[model samples]
Target chain A: MLPEPAVAAGKATRGWIDPRVRLAAALVYSGATAVWQKPESIAAALGFALGLAVFFRLAPGPVLRRLFAVNGLLALLWLILPFSLPGETLLQLGPLAASREGLLLALRITLKSNALLLALLALVAPLPFPSAGHALHRLGVPGKFVQLLLLTWRYLALLEQEFGRLRRAAALRGFRPRTDLHTYRTFAWLLGMLLVRAVDRAERVRRAMLCRGFQGVFFSLQEFRLNGRSLGFAAAVAAAVAACAVLEFGG
Target chain B: MHISEGVLSGPVLLAGAALAAAGTGVGLKKLAPDQIARTAMLAGAFFVASLVHVPLGPTSVHLLLNGLVGLLLGWPAFPAILVGLILQAVFFQFGGLTALGVNTLIMALPAVIGYGLFSRFLKGPRAGALAAAFGCGFLAVLLGGVVAGLALTFSGEHFLNVALALILAHLPVMILEGGMTALCVGFLRRVQPGLLPGRPSVEVR
Candidate 1:
């Protein structure tokens, strides 16, 4: 089975911030960090992300685990960029001389990646997935797209269970995956079966929705209003992001 | 392959976002109201299928299957793939918010291209159909890597080597996906040809 939804596990400590505000803040904070080039500003952005994580009451164990996962690609960049980038030499490892500019670029990427990811974990991960989709719809994302997002979220776990059952059946039938044509073919057939079943199930689902006189729009009972506190939270996030931008571009 | 957050420069990110928005707009237009459930269902299946790890020589790689997605959904692969990546960012945190546009483009564009190039061949002879499916799978990942590399290189000249290495690294995956796609398509052709794009439901024996 897939891991439990992070929001469910962290629900006890979830902040009272509106999902819309958290989403917008996460976007602004991530966008700010993305464009930031100055080390001072990027480091400050990371610090802000850390502070947000603490304020959101995200468990450090899960936060760090996510951080390490995101850093895997960064670690690869650290290995390649420092040696391949042409600049003033920082360290000579035999024929490959690590450039100072390359090291700086790598370091900047590392900091920026962590900052954006931590911000996402803190600001975005706490919202239940359906609420995020509704928040997106409220924020003017097209209704059709939001519907697709919600539906996909709805079926992801079911199809994951279906896939698991098929794999288990295969394993029961002595299917041990190896580096061979048979393995790839077997996996492909398994996937093909899943798709076929999904399409069949889709037909049933469509009919059921039609039977209930479903329309193009999905109605939700819960409504999100931007209360005073949520607006205040938005202002604080905007100010923090603006401060980082000023640090990078301000004279 | 997803380009991580904060690595792409502003111009690249902006360009990617603009293109992805355009693509998604067109795709949404093509998606009829009735097809929403079907599209979402297929997208969910693709999302789960992508989590499947197949063995390589000494390691394993998750299946991309973008080719099959494209072949099945045509233009709608854009929104489907976007939704998949969004779910990925939300649940797993594999890719982040900032890079969503580029990542969507990287995976979805090739999917559309694969559909355009290979869907017609699917109704042909078995050998040709399988061969075309193989091409689709191979070309999708190949193109995905190329676009990712371009995204990186455009971000900075320093990323050229990284770009090249990324493309080179995808070679094995291309072969694996190509073979799997061919087999998968063959299976579908036999069992449920109607599931394939542009095929008539009467073809379902």
Candidate 2:
């Protein structure tokens, strides 16, 4: 069996807001983004999320990688939204006429989504999965739910390695993926074999943990303490989001 | 496809979250202590499965296999899927935290349906198991996309196009998953036949 891998956690950024606080703040800010319909307000929310993204000191490389993954749905939005919405026609693309209202709606969605994504990146991505699990636990999330998340994160890398070995063995056997029944069957069999191996391995692990006094509850050695600075930051975030909603809706 | 953050309105988000929470509640209750490790293993598998992509039309899409998940595990599929989605949200930002509830509902509700369909039909005969697996795999994603698309359509005034695009884009995935699921059932039926639901007396792979 492989040793318990020392998966390095994210660097602890001192003087930053508490992760629990940030989690709460992100939730509040995202909720506000969902509710506020005024396009300007959504843009402002994006600005707020962007500022947090900067403050979080996130690297542009990881941020862009995330953006690329999400842009597929946004790409679909761009394709469909511009032509299907009702209002004054802005232009024509072959058989489709782009509407001004549709374009603006699409813009609003883009801003809202991008901003929320940035906000979450700042709020959640900086912490490793386990630490985030800690935050969720601290926020009164169910113990079982957090436990599940932690377990999945813990064994995911091991599972991936197992998957790699199986794929290589298949490749060694001259099995290549293509658009045919043979390709489909080979992949399916491979995945099925992986699942069987993982399940058997898990059974062994469970018995080991049981023998070693594993309990249903997880006890963490590190605890999160909320300080004055964290409280202050949460308050400031709340105030900014409220101000944005009021301005966009009332102004 | 996972609906990204901020696209859904407040009401839609709330509804999705509520439904997901309810599902999770039932799932937790139904799950046995012995099954926790198995669920985690499958959840881990589902989480990494996203990295395996299939070419579909112009752009490529990844395998979710929520159907296979549900068919094997029953109600536990909800939390398994939720855990996987949370990891994706954190690691790739494919979906946002606020939209977690909606994403869970979109993906797992269909899994629940697939479980019912598969369990009812999977144990009969080889041909029947293959067909059931194919249907489960294909319709699971197809229905999930439709659920999400309807949510998008109702969230705002001008979202019909978004709904149409989501439904249409996922059609290819539906067919792909069906074929994959059929093949997988065949493979599993031969090898680790115990993983599948049926009589103990069966032939070898």
Tens digits of per-residue lDDT for model 1, A146-232: 989999889889999998999999999999999998998889999999999899988998999899998887665558888888898
Residue-level lDDT of model 1, residues B67-162, one tens digit each, is: 999999999999999999988887888778888999999999999999999998887778888999999999999999999999998999767877
List TM-scores for all candidates, in order: 0.96, 0.91
Q: Kindly list the per-residue Cα lDDT of model 2 for residues A33-134, writing each as its tens digit.
A: 888888889888888888886776666776776677667668877777778777899898788899998788778888888888888777766665577788
CAPRI grade of model 2 = medium
- Give per-residue CA lDDT, model 2, range B1-205, as digits (tens): 7877767888999999999999988887787766778789888876666578655545567787888888877898898899988777666666778889999988899999998867666656778888999999998998898888888888975667657877897787888888888888778777777777545444544
DockQ, 0 to 1 scale, candidate 2: 0.55
Backbone-clash count (model 1): 0
Candidate 1, pairs of clashing residues? none
Segments in model 2 whose C-alpha atoms lie over 4 Å from true places: A1-12, A68-76, A92-96, B55-60, B197-205
How large is the C-alpha RMSD of every model relative to the true structure?
1.7, 3.3
